[model samples]
Structure formats: structure tokens, C-alpha cells
Target: MTRSVETTSSEDSELSLPAPKERRRLREAAELTHDEIAAAVGVTAATVRSWESGRTAPRGRKRELYTQFLARLAARRQDGGPAGPPGEAKTARAAEEPAADPPVPDPPTGDTPTPDPPASDRPTPDTPASDRPTPDTPASDAPSPDARTEPEQLPAEPPARVPVPGPAEAFDALYALAARDLARQAYLLTGRGALALEAVEKAFVQAWDRWPEVATDPDPVGWVRAIAYEYALSPWHRFRRAHRQLDKPPAEPADRILLDALLALAPANRRTVLLYDGVGLDLPDTAAETEATTPTAGHRLVHAHADLADRIPELADVPLEKQSALLRDLFTALRPAVDLEPRPAAVVRGGGERRTRLWTRATLSLTAMIAVSTSYTLMTAPTHYEPPPAPGESVSGVPPLAGPQQLTERGKQLHDKLRADPEAGPARIAPRIE
Candidate 1:
């Protein structure tokens, strides 16, 4: 197919790259951000970082694109443009340095020292009469300023003044580097693209809240990655309405199979495989990150490999390490470019601060309520028990029915007779009772 040929051509056209260090140096020299490079190359910023770290290299379309970008970056330096990225003041300062008078070179020497010419041969208008050397002066004496013949000394390179990014800038830079990769990794763990991005953003938000601690951590990227992974793989996410549905699988059959195999894994085995393979972590590190003992981590990895082999027959033939690379490839196919954009660093940080404040307020209110209730109870509660109230005696003689008293049988009869006598009612009044 045309696609196969294109991929082959791209892979075959790998550029003769410099040392991995050179790649990083070039980018830094240009003051380019990792996100910019990653975006242009159709890969995640983490992938770009790994490339510069020499832990991994791009292949296929990625290789061709990355090579082209690096080449351009190098060319930009060669073109005599500003050493820093365009529009930086560093270029202007660098320009001014070359214009400054270069350091004067020492006079050339030979076995027979060349004689200094008399003051008549070279006009020493600026030289003082006493300082000017005559023909009688020995060559060993300090040469007059005009007699200094060495080529103009090149300007000393200004101490490489690298601008240190501020805390907010540093956090944003880290976010730019790790956010995309974390999002992709999260997508690999959870089938939903939206949830994956959400998890990544949430991880950054948490990191921002604890910026001091996170920034000081030895492996800030790994710290963020671990948090993202935890959020993505959390069982509680399954309970969320939004995450209940799975995202569509990658359109390519190969990528879809890889994803399906990964999803079939139990979360532990899945996480172990991902950390060990997908992220290119060593065995010990994978175990430590997963919070498992080495032996347990190894077993999980074995099981994961077996499951993947069974589900993806082709992988059975590949070596364990290469399988990890293939796993990484699946992340890029999970979503398109538009969906991959994570929330901005500023927005994420602000949200985190707000969330922390809300929790703090809620906690203080709850504590206040508990304290008030305790004080009120202490004040109102009796110090000792009082004597009990007496029990009521049983009542006898009262009618069971509760209502106005019933008329006697005689009175009822007389009432009935009066009713029968009609107009005689007045005479038949109850006065008889009196």
C-alpha cells in the first residue's frame, strides 16, 4: 500500500544526527520549548525529551519529521541569525560584542627579533614622546601600540548567560514537557481520551498545589507521571458517568489490537508493563514506582507479556524490550491533534489553588461546628443523675368509653314519649327530674 511505502521511505531516510547532547544543545541554544518541537514532529513532548536524553529514538514518520526539524534548527544557527530564538535581546547583545575592540594580540617573535622601526616610519600621534621607542630601543622592550602586528584577537565569548525561568515559568515549562506525554499515557490506561486528558490535568493541578515539593523531587517528570497514571487507572473512574463509555479504538487494526490487549490486563499487570516497557523504565525503578517488590513486579510483567502475546500473536515473536516500543506507539493514535491539547498551565494552577481553598474553608467550618456542639453539651449536661419521677397508679371505675355521659334509660323513654306527643314537648320538659 502507499502508506507502507511512505512509512518505509521515511524510516529509510533517517538523518545523520549528532550526539543526543547536541540535539538538546541546539534546542536550548534556540530557546525553543519542547512542546513546540513535539507538536511539529507529531509526537508528545515527553517523546522529544526522551530523544534528547538518548533513551529512545524516533522511527517511521516521526524520524523523518524530527530530523527535518533539527536540521532547520541547526541551519538557523549557521545562518548568522541571533544565537537565541528570534526576537530575543541576546542577539542584540551578541552583536554589540563583536563591534567592541578585540583583545590586542602579542607581537610576533623569531630567533632574531625583528627590530622596531624608528618613530618616523610609523606616525605615533597618540603615543607620548617618552613612550615612543627609537631605533636604538631593543626588541625585548614593550612594543609601541602601533607596532603590535598580530591579527585582531577574536572577541572573548561572553559568559554564557542562561536566563533562569521563574517558578511559574519553571512549572509551565515542566507542564509543557510532560503534559502531552502524560495525557497519552493516561489514554493508554483508560480507553477514554477525555478522561485521559482530565487525569493529566488533574495531576498537574496537584503538582502545582505542591509545587515546592514536586519541583524539589529528584524525578519531577516521573512524579507527575505517577500521579497521572494513578488517576487514569483509578477504579473510582469507572463509577463516573462520563467514563462509563469507552472511546473509539484507533482506526488502524494493528493499533486497535495492541490497545485491546492492554485494556484486557488487570490494572496492576497493566501498570507494571507500562512502566517497565512503555516508559522505558528499568526493572527496579518500575517496581519502586508501582509500589511492588521486585519479584512481584517481575511476575506481573511476565503475566502481562503472556497475556499480550496471546492476544496479539505477532508480539509473541518480538523481544520483550521492543514490545514496549510498540506499546508507546499506541498512545499517539488514541486521539487526534485537536483533542490532545491539555488545559493551559495558568488555568490548571489557578483551578488547583481554588480547589485547595474550598477544601480549607469546608474543613474550618466543620471544625467550628464540632467545637460549638461540644461546648453547648458541656454546659447543658447534668453533672449527676437526679431522682426518677414516680410511676402512675392504675385507674379503675371510669367507663372504657371516653365522651359526654349517656342519658339514663328512663330519661330516654320520656324523651321518646315527648317526641311521639309532638306539640306536648314543652310540658314534657325534663323539669320532672328537678
Candidate 2:
């Protein structure tokens, strides 16, 4: 009687109540473990449990993350249709049932009158069966040895099932965009063309595997570019035997003078500058991705430009403000250059700039002009023609303009600036070039 009286008195003055409605909302949205939610929100699992149970409440970003988590979960469920959660009885039931599609009609009885063909094919009683081939065969059709003449023996092995791509094959185009962007950025970052290509390819392959999430991201390429940079800077890359700085100078091209300037800075500054310059990420985004300050990113870009001027004296002629613009154009052109690398069918889009098609048309136009000139020349003088013999050795047609040497040259320019800058002249500078 005393315990009941105390419980009733406490209930009358209730101030703190458990948030059961909020907990139920979260629970219905996803099958998140308490630990996972807590870890994401920087809280303990016990705290998460208390919150979920309405014994406590989370606030700020923690709450926001939870809400996002639920939203993402809901999106995934909606995509998969109204089956209960995956692996549940409802899902299993749907899997077991045949899909209601490709409707089949009842077979017609032989006694039913058949409809005649249209006016063009109106065959009367006077028409003969011999005038046309039977329904089972066309005029050119024939039963091969492996056909219905006999029960054919099975092959030694069944052919492997190749995956059929769906009509929605634009994933490859999206992937190529990400790869091209990452490759250009990586090239600017490492000043090593091959490494940049490899890094971008790896990142793109990973992105392709998670195309669904990537498709929804506003800046998929930006996400990939950041991930690629991180991959290049990972422990295996940084602390391993391959940790030496790029030793050789990049090949040179006259037109690539401006790009050759930007690729000249130290790796850190290279990344910061390139993230802003190459990928078109804003200063804050660059800093966030690179784990640097906005001011630091700005400084890095300034230092990068200065270094570019130092190494490539010609770059000094270009105004500092114009250097950024020049670098942007250089990278824009280089994107297509690296994209020349062979990629899977899924990775090429039909609608983008068709270089081959354009080239073919241009070639044909030039050939027509040459043909007209040759015809007139032949009429003026009877010329004896002797064709040169083909060379014995095979040559790869104009060995793909060896990875933009100009970008690397620009990189060296920045490196030189770092060496000369009084502020960067600290212990970081070494006389012995790596």
C-alpha cells in the first residue's frame, strides 16, 4: 500500500519523460546496431541504447547524422520495393513466386475460323500450298546437321555466361568523367603521368563498384579525386620502398609550357593547388579534402604559382593572375590526352565528343582536296609513280604524345620556387634534389 502511494505521488510530478516516439521512428527506419550509430555520432553504445530507449536524448550533429542515416536507409528500402527488410519472409515469398509479366493467351482451337491475311496477302481457295514455304521454314532456311534431324549431343562444356549490360549503361560515362578528372588532378599532384593514370583508374574502378551511391553524390568526381589522393598518400605508398620523390624530369612540349609550371611544386602544395586548379574545387573544399586550412590552401596555390615562375622563366612572362587561367586550360586539354588509354566498353559514352568520327570526316575532306590536285597534276604531266616499300620494323603510329611533359616541367618550376622562397628555406629545403 505504501509503495503504490509513493508511485502515484511520483507520477503526478513527472518532468522528464522518455522519447518513445523518436526511438520508434529511428528503429523503423533502419537496422542499425547501437555501436555503429554511437561510433558515427561520437557517443558510447550505452548512450545510444539509452537514447533509443527514450531514457536520454542526443543533440546537434549527432542527431543530424542519425537522421541522415535513417533517410539513407529509407531510400535503400524504397529502391528495393515494398518487401519487408532484406532476407525477411516477405522477401523470400516474392522470390519464390513467378513474376506477373509477359501475359500468355489461351491457345486457339483448330475448329475456330482463322482470320485471313490483309488485302496484300488475301489467299483464296484457288491458291496452292506449294506457292509458299510452310510456317516452320523460309525459302532460305535449312536444318543443319545439329538441328532437328537428330537429338544433338551436348557440347564438351557449356559456354560461360557473360553478363548482359542493361539499357541503363551510363554508369561507364559517369565513371570515365570521374577517372578523367582524377587522372588530371593526380598528374598535377604527383608530376608522374603514369602514377596519375594508375591512381585515377583505381579510384574509378572502385567508384564503378559503388555506382549507386556515386550517382546520387552532387560532386562524384570530387569525391573520387579526394579518395584517389588519399590512396596515393596511404601508408603503403608513403612508408614503403617506393617512397622516393619523382626523380626524373617530365618530357617537354612547347604548347604545354603553362602546365609545366604548376606541376613543379612540393607534393603537399601540389595537391592543394591542383585540387583547386585542376578539379575546380573551391578553397574550403580543397582544404577539407586535403586536411589543410583555407589560408594554407591559398598560400599553397600562391607558392605553387611562384615556384612555377621560378622554374619556368617563360612563365614569369605570363602575369601571375593569368597563370591560373593558363593552368586551367592546360589541365582541360590534358584530360582528353590521358583518356586515350584503352577502357572497357562500359566506360565509353556514345554521346560525348567523338574524336574518331571527327577525325575521319576531317581526313576525308583533306583527301578529297588532295585527290583533286593530283588529278589536275596528272593531266598536265604523265608521271611515272614508284611506291616505297613498307618498312620491316613495326612502328606504333605516333607513339601517343608521351604523357604531357609540359605538366611536369611546370611542376619543376614550382619546386624551384619552393627552393628559392626565403620562407620555405627552412629545414624542408635540401640542396640534393630527390
Candidate 3:
């Protein structure tokens, strides 16, 4: 009597999953590097390498996700699309190039070339050529004849020209240049791609609101990066963590363990390590951003380094100066996989203002109510009634007469005694009263 064996379709599918090496081959064929595939699969590059080396394999949902991602990547590659995160290659290219100035419109030209304006009336070199009034315009349109004649007296000191890059333009330029890098840093801080992008967008919105101040600052990128870091570390994110699902599958145990160790440090220590080691901020700058003294920031960094070294002994051999670069590379390789669309500037600003106003109003109302209640209680409360002192008695706990009649009689007696003893000594009156 032999028992027949039965297997469900799901079991069969699980059994038929590709070997770890095969998976790696598929990913490589799709033009995806270990880090790229790791990001797509929400695991560390080490885990991807482990998979390729057949030392470990993804299981359950992660295995399914890895398969799906590879398939999609292969399809995209076949279609001749770039095989990495959107804008990633472009951002890298842009960083390699010189800072790009905003595009200026070409100056309008007529059939004939116009001669340059006179030296005295010539526009400054910094001014865009298009902004200059066309010399070809009729004399009537070239400012009022009276105005030109009046300005001929002097150049009027160039109208106290403002800085060329206005706040709005400066902010736009900075956003274009630094948004990707800022988001990447945020991802390192938060270990969640969506949260990181959200934090960056929020920081940008704040920067936009205060663009005049931010643009004039010595380090606007640092300012925005600090904001993103603080936003990523907000406690509110913990509550949202469970609800915020990643598009990519869960990370491997080693990756998860490493992230847990990093996060287990105190917030200050974690922030110090991330900024100093991961983001390459100097102690003073990190201190300024974290609102600590440089010495304190340094201490925090040391402790953080020790903690990390305990978890990852490989870091112990890294040089002090190169540790930052090493940590940065590590985080970049492990960045989470997600693409985010930034909220519109207007929407973000409006929502932030609404929340601030609501909070302000609530706080003011609460304070006013407390003040009113306190005032009412103080005004209506019963007061202590201290009786008037009787004759021959001080208010300092002196015993009073038994009755009003007794007090009047005592006063009368004292008056009579004093009148009778006008020529007598005060000792005689005191003896009589006793």
C-alpha cells in the first residue's frame, strides 16, 4: 500500500524558482549591477552579491519581487530604455558638467546689424543682451526725450542694481542642481526611499518659502540638507512606518540587522554619524545643524563610530578621514528603491501655512482661555476678612474684648484714668490698666 504524493500549483512554482546564480545572470543580462538590483529589490548590495555567489537566496515575497523586477528590467533594456532609476544617469551627467546657467532668450535681431550703444549709456556686461532696449527702436520709444535728457546728467548710480540671480531663480537653479543628491542623503538618513523623497520635497518647499533668505545664505544646499535630515528623523515617521509600504520587497536579514543597529543609536548620535560620516559634514557644520557644540558633535561622532564598529568590524580598519567617504559609499549602495513625484510648491506651501495657522490659533485660544479662567477665579473667589483691632489691642494676634460693650467700657475707663491722672506718671496709668 503506497501513498500517492500531491503538490499544489503554488508549491510547484516555489520549487521551480531559479537558482541564485541564475537570478544573478538574469540581472546582469538586464544590464543591472548588484547595487542597482539590490536597490530595486530593497536589499543591500551585499545581499545581491551573496545571491550571485550562491551563498544565500531570496525567499517568499522577496524572491517573487526579485523575479518581477528582473523581468521588467530586461524588458526595459530590450526596449532601449536606460536600465537604472529615472534621472539617475542624467543627474550623474549633470554633476560632471559645469554649473548650468538658466537659459536666456536670444536677442531679437533685424536684417541689419545694430551698432553698439555709446560707452556712457552702454548696459553693464552682466546684463542680458535681450534685456537691453533695441537700438533699432524709434527715438520716440527710446525712453521719453525729456527722461533721456534728464538722465544724461548722470547714470543715476545704476539704479542700485540687485544681485543678478533673484531669489526665485536661485532657488529653482539650486533645486535642479541638488534635489537628487539631497534626496539620496535623506534616503541614507531614513532608510526609506519614499520617506526620503518626501523629506526632500518638504525641505524644498520650506526653502522656496524663504528663498530670499535662503538664497542669500552662504550655504543654501547645506540649509536644505539639514532640513531634510531633521524631517527624516521626525518621530511622526515611526507611527507611519507600518502603513508606508515599500514597492520593493523587504530587505534581507543582514541588511535589516545593520539598519536596526544604526537606528538603535540615540537620534543625536545617529544624526551626527550620518552627517559627519555619511554626508561628509565637518564637526562645526554638523554641530550648527544639530544645535550642538562642536565638541559635543565630535563626542557623538566618536560614540557613533564605536557603535558602528561594534556591528561592522570592517570599519575599524578604515582611516579617520576616509571613513566618511566609505560610509557614504556604503549608504549609496544600499539606498532604497523608489521614484517619487514632488508635491507642487503651491500645494506644499499652502498646506504648511494652513497647519501653522491652525497650530497658532489653537495655542492662542488655549492661552486666552486659561488667562480668562484664572482671572475669573481670582476675581470671584472669597477673600479673607480680617476684623478691626479693638482698643488697647494690636493686630499682631492680640486677644480681643468679649463683646462690643466690654470694648467701649474699657476705652471709657482708660480715657477717664488718663484724664484723672494728667499730672500722674504713665506708670500709674499702666498699673491701673493691668
Candidate 4:
């Protein structure tokens, strides 16, 4: 069962191979079929599989040969050769070459590298081979090149490969930071928690859909905020069932009053005030966001402040220019009556995609239907034209088509005379002699 090859030394008696899993991977990568490996290793295909699977290992001469074969495989792989055994010709040629008189021993693979000796002990152009300092010689006995390491002291660049955020990651970061706050603001506008959350989610969906524009925008958050505010303030929402009824008021009397005041304002005025006072935007910004002129935005803001101040005495004391601080503080103090949780980024992105798909399908279907209808009308229409009838004309003496009149007595008697004698009728009518 154990046969040792003549050339197999005690050191080569044992073999070291990769782990079972790694062996399988390497074997597959080498394009070595089970049969090819089995033939090369002088074993059956099943035996090769067993070896690779860690079910068994070769012993004696077989183990030695297997180790050599693995070394050849790795060497061949490193050399980038075609999938085949590493050539023995090179190994044999190396073995046949002459050896130097003083053989330098190969370094141990696991040992730490020895430090370089001083420059003086190192072999220079004039130094003899025997006189040159070896690793065993002390560094103090040699010399140092402190100059070489001094250049490393200057400041180096910041670490490279910083892993910049991708588009999706950046989008998610923006959403995570802004979604909750945006929803709260939306709730302030709509006075409905669910609608507020829906508005923010839909806004994010659109933002993701147009991410190229949104990402490149100088103020992505503001872009998203505008969309959310527009959706929350949309008049069409009033027709929906969810928005038809008033949402429950907040617990705090002050917040409830403020929310009521806000909701009562026309959408334009409310948005302008929210942007200017609550969101801390300037008049020009508020005007831009609300799609109104600066004067109009200011007008709305002054009126809104007046209205709110009328309802809330605290705001009434604050002047228009100073109202922003008070209003922003009041809005911040207002707690949402309900939990307004915005959807995940994934959900918003996927919903946007789905909505786009449905709209695209509808548009295509409509186009197809129109094309078919036009085609059908063209195919089935009458091609030939019948001549139109000539218009009627009025004659000079033609009487109107009235029913026949009753016969007179003279005509009746003549008719009786003709019936009595046919010849007398013609002779009386024809001659009429005196």
C-alpha cells in the first residue's frame, strides 16, 4: 500500500494542498476534468473527487508525485501558460546547469526580513566579496543612510479612494434627512397627517424620477419642498374622500389655532406665508417658490400675518418684518396630531416607476385606438359619389296640384248623350253646324 519513489526525500514525503473548497475552485479554474486529473495523478476519477472533497489523501510515493504536480500547476498558472501541466524540460535543464562554488541558501518563506546594514559595510565597487558585510553583521559595524528616510517627513496627500457616494446613496441621504421635516411642514399646510405623508412621498417619487435635474439643482431640498407644498396645497385633493373631512385638531390649543389659521388661508397666501415666515425664506424666495411677484408675495404675507395675529394675540404684537421669528417658533412648537411617517426611498422610487409605467401604457393604448379608429373610418367610407338631382323650376301657367272638382250639369248631360249614341256624340261635337 506504501511505495516510495527513489527520488522522494523525507522532506518531500508529505504533501500540502489547498483546503477542500479551495481545491475544488482551483481545479475548476484550471479546466482540469476529473478524468484528466485522475489520469495525471494515477488515480480513478472518483478518487480524485474524494481527494478534492477532503474525503481522502494520497500517501507515500503518490503523495510526493501529487505535491509536485500541484507545484507545477501553480507555476504554470503564474506563467500564464495554456491549461496544461508545467513543462519538466525547464526543471531538468535547471538541474543540469553548473552550480556556483559558494551556494547561497534560499531564504525561509516564513522568516521576517533582516534590516539593511550600514552603507560602509555594504559592498561598493571597490569592496571584495568576502569583505562585504552580511545580514549577520551588526548595523553599528556598518553604516546608515539616514538621508533616504528624511524625504518621507514632508506632508503627504490625503488618503485616496475615499469612496464617494453614488447617485442612489446621495438620494437616500437627502431623503433621510429631509423627509420627516418636509412631512411635518406639509401637515401644517394641509392639516391632515396622512395627506401630508402622501404629499411628501409623492414629491420624493417625482424627485427620484427627475433625479438628473434634481441632483444637479443648487437646492435639491428646496426643489423637493416646492413639489411637496404644491401637492399638499392642490385643489384637486379636496375632491378625494380622505381629504373631504377635517382632520382632528392638535392637542395643544395654540397649535390647533395656528393650524386652523393656516388652513383657512387661500393656498397661495398660505404657501407664501409658510415659505416666508415658517421656512425662514426671504420675500424673493417666497415669491419664487409660490410663483408670484415679490409685491404679491409680500401682500399675501402681510395679510396672512394680520389674519393669524387677529386670531392669535401673540402674533398681533409682532410686526410684519419681525413676524418670521415668532411664526417659525410657533410652527416649531406645533406638534402633528397624527404620526406622519414618510415612505422608504425604495417605496417612493418604485411607486414613481410604476406610475410612469401605467401612464405610458395608457398613452400608447390611446394612440393605438386613435390610429385604429382613423384607419377603420378611411377603409369603410363610401368612395364613389352619386350625381345630385337638378333643382325644380316654377312654370308660368301651371296650376297647383289640387284634387279634381265635381262635374258641372252641362258636362254631365253631354256625358249621358254620348253614352246614349256614340255616333251622335262625335257628329254633334265635330260639325256644330248652324
Candidate 5:
């Protein structure tokens, strides 16, 4: 018996193929593991899990390859090929069954034996077993070579195994690894644990939302650190300064004095000292991060050191080489202790997009409103009027006829007349008064 197979176009396979369930079915039917499929598609097994779990879908070249792989498996099944070892049992059973009784009635047809019903019209005994279904069994009950396989029902309590980390897992790992250090850094910069925590949390949430991009970055932690630093410095947090001062934790007397002295310095000087002396960043790098010129950064650092020395006379005695080391140790001691744990992935990912969209809308609205207000003000503002020039006086462009000495003498005479008559006014004194 001949079987007809339907073929799918590459475009259809790539663009219109069913997702996780269909992919899962094809994989199970072919007795292939996720790793095997991943290797065939040139992706990680974790990526394959992501596809099967609906976390992500294959796209571009990967999608094309996955589609083609599934199509080949489907074709193999359609052509009576064994899906795997399980198929071999069915083949053996079909082979053991006796062939249908040969054409016995043909013998009565006389000498020529009626040239045995043309071979094309008769079913071939050699036809593969998969094409034939037993009458006692329903087609659905018996697994068909062409039918897609369904995932087997797993036990209520599945066995424990290590799970591969997908994008979400990787992001959580990164956050867990970096959050505490980032928070501590922010705390050192802002001098308030709560504000520092808030900044670090916000930056991490943003990182989580854009994990695919962040995961591929050369220094994802540094990117998040920069964001956290900027967040701590935002003007919106200034109102919290009084509260922070009230809630400041007590420190060793020396450390306390040092911190107070550091805080007293100008913000630029303080930041330069912290980034260069405390954090051990090079001058150029510190300057770039702080948005200052190298020369300006050097000036700030030098002034900061001088100011600190002036505040604590003991610092003046410390050698130049050891001063940076001392400051680094002092800053390290000042960093607030941070107890950090990985935040819920969903929560971290959810709020960032909403916040971004709201911020964008608000900014656009504010800009448009400001533009309109400015245009209206410029258009409606009253124009200044200048009185017509005195009849004998020249306009601004003409040079004065009188020499400087003559003008000076005339001015003196006018001043003397005004002094002699306390109430003398320009209108009364002028010869051309109407």
C-alpha cells in the first residue's frame, strides 16, 4: 500500500509552526532529548528549555533550523521509519502475524491463473507494519507513526534534579552576586542606608527588565553600579537629608570625625576624594565618571586632601603615600552593612517597564507644555516704548559734537543748579517746556 505525505514549506515551518506544545510533541515522538535538539539547532539546552517552557521562542536562523529539524522527523515517521526503540516492538509483532491467505480462488480461473490481479492493485506483504492498524484497536489508542506524541503525565512528586539556568535564572544570579556590594557602595556615597538601598534596588530592577541586553554587556555590574550611583545623587532624594542626619549610626570617634569632615567638603571635592583615594580609581576614570575634566578632578582631589588635613591636623602628619591607604581604610569602615537577597524575578521585571513608560509620557507632556507657555509669553509680552528724542539731540548712531571737557563742564553747571534749587526738576529747568 502506498502512503501520501504532506510537505510543509520552509516559510510556513518557520513562521506558522506551533510553539512549545508542538515542539515538545515532535521532540518526544522522535525520542530526542533537549540537548540533542539544542545541538541540532545550535543553541544551548537551556535555550531549548526556554522554548519548551514558553519563556522565549526561537527566531531568525534558529527558528528556521528548528522548523527544518521537526519537518525531517515528521517525514521519517510518515515513511514507516521507526521513531525509536519502542517502534521496533510493533514492527516485530506485525512481522510475526501470518500473511493474509494467498489468492486461493485464482486457481479456479483456469490455466493462466488470471495473471494474478495486477501487482499494483494488490497490497504488498512487505509493506511496513506502521501503515496497518489492527481492527481490535482504535487508531487513537494505538500510536500511529505519523501522529504527534503527547507528553507523558509526570508523577505528582517529580524527582529532584538540577535545573539549567535560563535568562531569568542568570539575571537572578547576577543580582544576588552584586546587590550587597552595590548597596554598600551607594551607602558610602549617600551616607544613608535607606537611600542607598532604594537606589540599588531601583537600578537592579531596571537591570532585570533589560536582562537580555545586560547579560551580554561586558560589565553588567559596572553598568548597574553607575546607575545606582547616579540614583543616589538625584535631587529628589535631597529632602531625606534631615531624616538621614537624625538616623545616622554612631561610629568610632575617629571615624565619626573623619566622616563629618568628608561630608563637610564640597560635593565635587568629596566625590573626587571617594572615587580616587577611597575607591582607587585612576584620575582619568574618576573624572569621566564624575563628568569633570582631568585637571578639575586633580584640583578637587588636592583641595579635598588639604581640607581634610586642615580639619583633622593628624592627617597632615601622615605621609602622602599612606594618606590614600588611610582614606581607603576609613571609607571601607564607613560603608553600611547590607543584608541582601535576590528579589522576586517577577516583581523586579514588572515595575520597570511601567515606570519607564510613565516617565516618558510625563517628560513629553512637560516639554510640550513648556514650549507652548514660552511661545505664548514671547508672543504676548508688552513691547517697550522709547520717548521721541529731544528736538536738538542726535540719535544714538551720531557722535556727540561737544568735546569730553565741554560735556563735563556742562554737567557740573547742571549739578550746581540742581543743588542750589532742591526741588529743581528736568521739566521746570528745560528751556523747551510746553
Candidate 6:
């Protein structure tokens, strides 16, 4: 079926998949190159080529835009709206060529162990102890009658008890719920199914590391939403690298239009509006979700409104004339973008075993190499081989020659010194002076 939403201004063609001829005509009418359209939708030029070739139809936002782009073209044509210059389209297309990939850092070297910084540099202060250690127990007043050597006993106090929710239970509940909500909001704002899922997953991983604090918060969902929004806008998310090849934009005109509109948005504005209006979060809550102040969030929402009014004029009037329609159009347009289907949770049942197997293999390989090299060296060397000495030099299992005599000499000297002193070692006892 034709995935694009129907509009009054233009007739939509059949939607089994956009025909190559229909897509080309739409592209020509919109004055967009395949690359330009692809860049707009954040896909690869190859993908765009595929769409035009009738090999595939753009899914998600690209699918949603099929009707919207044509309608916009029809509207512009009717109104004689000045088409943006040809050079602008050409320049944008040129900019879409894949750039050089960033250099990946090498994995950590085994030679260098990560050193722990000194305790003094640690964030929290250490609790200092009192001058004297507390005694375990005072001397007992009386001994037991059962035996003369019976030891004195001290009374025992009951163990102290604390009451609070279990940390892991609370943490799990907050993370699971907040993560799901954040993913939904991301899909709504970006309108890209994969992007929304990624944003949610990224936010949850980050939250996992700080669950202790986040779980205790009054609004964990808000916190997760904010994190997801930030992640959605990150440079990494902006450019998706699948396999070794760059993204190819969808070829269909509708897909091109939708992609272009989404790309036009500044990340912050898109995130703010989605988190606030789309997810029904208040301004303060939106700010919390986006990690911004209320004023900043308010400004983003305003800019988002302006951006919407400037681009996509069809949806604009509804929002302007009927506040409800504006909200409805936004939700409708964005719903496909952010829609996340039920997914199986990631399972790592045998991860430990796999890791252990890998380590074992690596160790065996390394050991084999070392043994081979050592054996080669020993075999090739000159033939006069001396076995290592036994632990002790003396026969009959007696210690080495320097052991017993030295201890006996030390003991004799100590005894002679003690006997030579009048008070054993000149005691420091108080004297009766009188």
C-alpha cells in the first residue's frame, strides 16, 4: 500500500511500492537529486538509488514522506512558490559523498596495567579513627566455677537491622520502565525506528552505570528520556555506519521529502518538542529529560514550532488554526519514526563460557609458542648442561652451612649481655629515694 499520508493538494499514485517512473517524476518535480534526497532522509545514496530502481521502498519516515513531498511539490506549483536554486541542490548533493572514516583507537595493551590514583585524590573523605581503639570487651568481674582456667566472658548485643527497598529490585524496575519510555519518545522525535531503538539502548547502558542515583530519583522516566534525547542527537547517531558502506538515500520522492524535513531540524529542537509535546511531558519535565533548564527547553520548543511552520506548511495551518490538529499531525507524522516493536531481550547465557574458552585458547597458543622457542634455544645451545642445585647444600636434609651456627651465636651473645647487666637491662622502675 502507498505509505504516504493523503492530502487534498495532490493525487497519490498506487502504493504497492513507488514505481520508478513515479519516483523520478516526483524527484524532478521536487528539484532534488538522489543524493540530495538521501542526505535529507539520512540514508545512503545507494539506498536512494535502490528506491528509484524499484528494488526497495523507504521504510519509516522515508515511507511517511512519499505523499508529503508530492503534496508540497503540488502546492508549490499551484502557488508558483519560487523553487530553491538548482545550484543549492547540486551543492547539497555533492556534500553527501561519503567522507573518510574516523580512525579507530587500538585496543588496550596487556603490557600496561591501569594504575590506581592515590587515596588522597579520591572524591570522598575517609572516616578518621579516634585516638584509642574501642575495647572489644572489659575484663569480667568473676570467673566460671566449672574450671580454674575458665576464661572471662563478655555479654553480647543483638545485631542492628536496617529497613529499605532492595537496591537491585528498585534499580531494575526504574531502568526497564524508563528505558522503554525513552525509546518510544526517541522514535517519535526522530521518526526512525532503528535510531529510536539505539537511542533507548544507549541511554539505558549509561543509566545502568549510575542506577544507584537514578533509581532513587523521583522521575526516572524523565531522566532516561533526557538521556535518550541527548544520545539521539549525538554525532555518532547522526551518521549511521552499516557494514563498510555508507548510507544510500531512498529514491522515492515521498521518501526524499520526509528525509529532507527530518535532516533540516537541529537536533536539540527536535528532541525538545518530541520529549515535551509528543510524550506529554511538561516544560520542566522536558528540560529534565533533555538535561537543560526550563528556559532552554522553552526556547527549543519555540524554535521547533517556528521550524515546523517554515517547512511543512500543510501541517502548519492545522496546528495554527486548531491546536488539536497541530498536535495530531505531529503525533501522526512522528509515530512512524519512533514506533518500536516488541523485541527479544539480549541474551548472553553462555557468554562466560565463550569468554573462558577464548581465554583458554589464547593462553594455550601463547604457551605453545613460548615452549617451542625455549626448547629450540636449549637444544641448539652447547652441550655442557648443569642441573640446578638442590634447595639446601648440607647432606642429611640439614639446612645450609650458614644457618644453625649463626642463630646459636646470636643466642649466646644475647645471654652474655643480659648476665653482664646488674638489673638485667637497667630497669626503669621508680626508686624509693629515701
| Residue pairs that clash (backbone atoms under 3 angstroms), model 5 | none
- The reply for model 2, stretches above 4 Å from the true place, is 1-168, 238-264, 332-342, 345-434
Stretches of model 1 off by over 4 angstroms after superposition: 1-164, 313-322, 325-338, 371-434
- Which has the greatest lDDT? 1
Tens digit of per-residue lDDT, candidate 3, span 57-146: 554345667767656544555555454544342332232366667685555468767566578777888889876877487756677534
Among these predictions, the greatest TM-score belongs to 1
The list of candidate 5 runs beyond 4 A from truth reads 1-164, 240-246, 335-434
Two-way lDDT contest, 1 vs 2, winner: 1
Residue-wise lDDT of candidate 4 within 121-163, one digit each (tens)? Answer: 4578887877876769976665444444446566787877878
What's the true lDDT of residue 68 in model 4?
72
Per-model TM-score, in order, reads 0.56, 0.36, 0.40, 0.51, 0.41, 0.37
In model 4, the clashing pairs are: 118-143
Ranked candidates (lDDT, high to low): 1, 4, 5, 3, 2, 6
Which scores greater on lDDT, model 5 or model 6?
A: 5
Q: Cα lDDT for residue 104, model 3? A: 55
lDDT of 2 by residue, 95-162 (tens): 34676865645544679865764675555677897664467784347443236446758869888999
The digit string of per-residue lDDT tens for model 5 on 63-178 reads 66777777876665666555555433233224346779555343232365435545554556887666644457754585542343456677799778988889877876877777
Clashes of each: 0, 14, 0, 1, 0, 19
Return the candidate ranking by TM-score, descending.
1, 4, 5, 3, 6, 2
Q: How accurate is candidate 3 locally (lDDT)?
A: 0.66
lDDT of 5 at 414: 86
- Candidate 2: give its CA RMSD in angstroms: 35.8
Q: What is the per-residue lDDT of model 6 for residues 286-368, given as tens digits with 9 covering 90 to 100? A: 66566789799888878776776566644455544233234434454533422375242231113333555888999999999
Q: Give the residue spans of candidate 4 off by over 4 A.
A: 1-145, 148-166, 316-322, 381-434
